[model samples]
Target: MLPLGGSHAVAEGQAVLLVAHADVTTQRLTRDTTRAIFAMRQRTWPDGQAARVFVLPNDNPVHERFVKERLAVYPHQLQLAWDRMVFSGTGQAPDRVRHQAEMLERIATTPGAMGYLEREYLDDRIQVISMD
Candidate 1:
């Protein structure tokens, strides 16, 4: 088992969650911007390119970790925000994938796509976005 607070622990990685996309840009996103993107509040990156956000189900552990640790928000809060956005016609929810492989596939193929992943599941197809 992974050691408590180990270098590989999910919690530890969650704090510095790797946000990757298919684009070649070396843009490092600010924390607020990252939060805005995931919260569906921001539609474009700093470069003005449309940002396509992907995510796993709300109940998934990695999803929970990402929301809580990376975004500094709770899953339920994010869900409520998403609901408000969709119902208000101001924004739409992110594309959802069932697992890491699917998330990887979507982000790697889709343009301006962004999503968080554990380091081990990461590969070359996706470009990492650093959080400011």
Candidate 2:
């Protein structure tokens, strides 16, 4: 079993939850690919699907730490990358959700929505993607 309240516990296929205002295209991403996509590196899938990322609020410690340690990128770097994309009119950053529950709800309803969540919280409506 994975430990609680630490970065190690969140691994591949563990269902990372994301939230938005009820519209976005993203769901069930590989852990490494998700990390890359979130960092704004991998823009499209091998199948030619556009990668859409949804992120939690910056203030959330879990979100911050995950990006820092797992992605090996700072939040400011993510912002800068996103800003650059926006300025260039390439693609904007993923939408944001207000809270975990909201993220779950929005991701559940939205097609192609991808997000992370604790494995314990997963349900039938949400499909967990393996980070392994």
Candidate 3:
């Protein structure tokens, strides 16, 4: 579990929560499904809505924590997968946001969007997605 009250980049530990647009029908996802979506392998939610994935920079600590702790992979591995998908024309990378604020704004406004956030950064504009 992520600890409470941290800095923007996470201070020691993170309670990064997977979040989605307020109107999304799906409330929970399995780890594999979440990983596939973020890895650019899954294109739609279980309810059949197109999945719009958002991500932070490869070097961001929050991203590192989310990728490693939640997704069970290193940041570089995810990046390499994205690079291969882009170069081979098999797939594309997620929409890259600058920070949590922008990630919140984009996911809040865009339908079928999904991303991660520090617990304190969450607002009613988005819905917290539970990992099933």
Per TM-score, the best of the predicted structures is 3
List RMSD in Å for every model shown: 3.4, 5.5, 3.7
Model 3 Cα displacement at 75 (Å)? 0.7
Candidate 1 segments whose C-alpha is farther than 4 A from its true place:
1-16, 24-26
- How many clashes would you count in candidate 1? 0
Error of 2 at 80 (Å): 1.4
User: Where does candidate 3 stray beyond 4 Å?
Assistant: 1-11
Ranked candidates (TM-score, high to low): 3, 1, 2
The whole-model C-alpha lDDT of candidate 2 against the native structure comes to 0.61
Taking all chains together, each candidate's TM-score versus the true structure is 0.86, 0.67, 0.90
Model 2 error, position 95 (Å) = 0.6
- Model 2 steric clash total: 20
Per-residue CA lDDT of candidate 3, range 11-110, in tens? Answer: 5655788999998999999989999999999999999999999999999888999998779899999999999999999999999999999999999999
Q: After superposition, how far is residue 104 of candidate 1 from its true place, in Å?
A: 0.2
